[model samples]
Target: MNHEISNQLKQNQDIRENLKFLAENFSGKIVFSTSFGIEDQVITDVIFSQKLSAVEVFTLDTGRLFQETYATWDKTQIQYGQKISAYYPNNKKIEGFINENGINPFYESVNLRKQCCHIRKVEPLQRALKDVKIWITGLRAEHSPNRNELEILQWDEQYELYKYNPLLHWTTEEVKDYVTKKGVPYNVLHDQGFVSIGCAPCTRALKEGEDFRAGRWWWEDTSKKECGLHS
Candidate 1:
C-alpha cells in the first residue's frame, strides 16, 4: 500500500481499538456529537453496533436547521433507540447577539460569522464536551481543504481532550454505501445537493461540478468557508 493509505488504515484501526479501550478505561466520560449528516450516520453505526460504553450521542439544535435535518434526527433516534441529546443556543445570548449585530450580520464579514457560530455552536460544543475525556467527531479528510492532513485520532488542543474521527479514512462513496446497506438514518439533504449541513441561513446547496464544501457559506471566499465548528 502507498504510505498515505497505510497511514490512514493504521489511524483507522487505532481509533476503533482505542474506542474500545476508552470505553473500559474511562467508563462514563466519552461523548460523540452528530449533525445527522451521512458521515455522522456512519460513526453512529459503529458506536451502536459495537455497543460502545459511556458514549453519549448529542446534536446541536441551532433552531435554524432545515426541517429535513430535524426529521432525520428524529428518525435516527427511533431507529437506534438511543437518545441523541439536543443542545440549544442560550436564548439570551442568541437574542442579544442578533439584536446588536442584525439577524444576518454574518454576511458582513467572516469575523461576524465566526462570532455568531461561537454563540450558536462553539459555546454549546464546549458545554457538550465538558467532563468528557474523549470527544468523537464525524470529520472526514475529504470534507475540507484543511482536513486533508487530519488523522483518525489526535489531541484537541482547544478542548484539551483526545479526539477521534473513526471514519477519517473512508471516502464519501464508502460512507454512503455503508449507510445504505445498513439502513442507517441520514439527513436527506445530502441527496438534494448539500454535501454538508449546518445552520439553514449559513449553508446552501452546491452547484454541479463544485467542490464538496462550496455549498456552505457560499457568499464568502472559498478559503473562508468554515464556521467556528471545525477550526
Candidate 2:
C-alpha cells in the first residue's frame, strides 16, 4: 500500500490531486491533524478550499496556545466553515499532573517535560487517532534534521497506521509563499519570527541564526528538545 501510494505521489506533483486521490481511495479513514502553523494553514487551505469532504480536519488544543493561534483558527473556520475538530488534553490527566507536579514541573526535568507532553499531547492524539487508518499531518522536511530523512509516506508502527506527510518535501519559503498567495488565514506569529509554534510557554520567536527547531523548548539541549509526538 505504501509503495503504491508513493508511486502515485511521484507521478503527480500537484498536492490537490494527490489529496483527492487519497480521499477517494481511503474514503472515511483519513484524518489530518493541523497545528495551525504556516504549513498546516497551507494544507488546511488545500483541503478546505478544495472541499475535500472525505478528509477529516482537526487540531490538538493543548490549552496553552497563543491567542494569535486561536484567532487564526477562528478566521480559518469563518473563511472555510467549521471543518477543523479540536481534540484537547484529558482533563483528569491534566489536573492530576498539575496537582502533583506544581503546574510547571515540565520546567524542572527532562523526564517531567516528556511526562507533561505525554499527557497533554501524545495521549489526546491517541484518542483522536483511534481506528484511523491514514493519519495525515503538516510536517515538512525543512523543520528539523530528524524530519529531513522521513519519506512522504510511510507506515507508523507505533500507531499501526499509514502516516502521510504531504508537505514533506516542501521548502520553508515555498510554504510561506503559498499561504500568502492563497490568501489563507495564518497565524501572524510567523511574521514575528515564531517558527513551529506549539504551546505558548514552550515556544518563542527564533533569533537571527536559529533553525526551525530552536523556537520551541529553547532552554533545553538540542538533543533533548523533542516533545515525543513526532519523535
Candidate 3:
C-alpha cells in the first residue's frame, strides 16, 4: 500500500474496518445507487454480504437505458434476491422538456445534456437520498482523471452526506477479477469495449486504443464530459 494512503486510511482506519465502523455508526437509513455496472455490482455485493441494515438500494431509469443494462438489472435482482428500487423522472417534467426541446436535446449542446441528466438522474437521486445519512456509490478513483483525487470516504457538500466509495483504489483489472470471481451480474456492454455505461443516446463503445471515457458524451469537450449526475 502507498504509505500515504495507508496513513490516510489509518486515520479513518482501512476500508474494511472503516466500513464496519461506519455501518455501525449510521446503522439505518443509508442508500447505495447502482447503475448495474461492474463497480456497482461489486459494491452491492459488499453491502449485502456484510448485512448492512436499512441500506436502500436504488437506480435511475433514464427511459433510454440499453437493453443489456436492463437485462443485467433483472439478473442482479434475481441473483441477490433484493428489492432494488427504481427511480424515474417525472412524466410531466420529461414530457415538457421533450416537447420544448424535442426528444433528443442532448445532441445540441452540453448545457442541454446537463438539463436532461438533472431530470433523469440528479433530481431522482436527490429524492432517493432524502432520508439517507450515507450515500454509497461504486465510484473508483481510476475511472476518471477528475475523480483521481477522491477519498474513499468524504462528505459530499452537494448532497450533504457521507459518500462512500469502497472501490476507490481498485484498478479496472481488480474490479473485473472480483466480478468474475464472484459471478456478479454486470452490463454486457463492458465486454464490448464500453468502460462507462450511461444514458443510451449519449454513450457508446470506445474505439480501439481510445480513452476509457471517450464513449461518454463524445460530442462534448472531453474536459467537460460529465453530466453532473456524478459530478
TM-score of each: 0.90, 0.96, 0.90
Candidate 1 lDDT over 1-231, as tens digits, reads 235533553545655565666576667788889998899988777777678847888999888899999899888778877778988899999999999999899899988988988889989998998988878899988888889877666768888887777888779888999888988988888888899899899888888899888888888885747777766
- Candidate 3 regions exceeding 4 Å error are 1-20
User: By TM-score, is 1 or 2 better?
Assistant: 2
Candidate 2 structure lDDT: 0.87
Strongest candidate by TM-score: 2
Candidate 3, clashing residue pairs?
A: none
Q: What is the Å distance of residue 155 in model 2 from its true position?
A: 0.8
Q: Any runs in candidate 1 off by more than 4 Å, and if so which?
A: 1-18
Q: Tell me which of candidates 1 and 2 scores higher on lDDT.
A: 2
As a whole number from 0 to 100, the lDDT of residue 128 in candidate 1 is 92
Please write out the lDDT profile of model 2 over residues 147-211, one tens digit for every residue.
87787878798899888888999888899899878898899999899989999888999999988
| Per-residue lDDT of candidate 3, residues 140-231 (tens digit) | 87668888978876778888876778778888998899889988888889999998899889999999888767899888875657767666
lDDT, candidate 3, at 115: 91
